[model samples]
Target: MVKVEFAAALQRHVPCAPQSVAPGTLRAVLEAALAAAPGLAHYVFDDQGAVRKHVAVFVNQQQVRDRVRLDRPLADGDSVFVVQALSGG
Candidate 1:
């Protein structure tokens, strides 16, 4: 199983807990994890189903490059971290 965790900053708004999901693409893993947390999807994805500009996803501590498709594949034992991206000068 792939481990998915949401940052504390984001959890304050939606209260999602870290969970284990079936190994798959980033989108598939997230879909499975977020399915248990109502309203959390709106904060992570936009109307087009792309990751929101303010969100960031990392796999095994490396940042994901494809936010639009979120097709990065995950294997068993991989760790996925989702956080709110910080911006501004």
Candidate 2:
């Protein structure tokens, strides 16, 4: 199973949640996560449903490219971490 971790900013949406999910592509993972916490969809993706610029997705410790192609395939035991980028100046 692939693990999905929500950053502190996202924890409010999912309380006491597991950090893993069934093995699948990024799309599948996000879909399932959204299914469980529909409210997160709007915060993570844009109106067009694309991952927002400030959102980052890491698979197995490798950062995923910012594109719809996050559909990148995943295997069992992999991990997917979803975090919101923070910026201040």
Q: Name the candidate that leads on TM-score.
A: 1
Candidate 1 deviant stretches above 4 angstroms: none
Q: lDDT tens string, model 1, 1-89?
A: 99999999889999998999999989999999999896899999999999998899999999886889888889999999999888874
lDDT of 1 at 49: 94
Q: lDDT per residue, candidate 2, 1-89, as tens digits?
A: 87777777777765436556777878888777667677777877888878888888777777787656667888888877778776654
Instruction: List pairs with backbone clashes in candidate 1.
Output: none
The lDDT leader among the candidates is 1
* Per-prediction TM-score to the true structure, in the order listed: 0.95, 0.84
Question: Model 2, 73: alpha-carbon shift in Å?
Answer: 0.4
TM-score of 2: 0.84
RMSD of each: 0.9, 1.9
Q: What local distance difference test score does each model get?
A: 0.92, 0.75
Off by over 4 Å in 2: 13-16
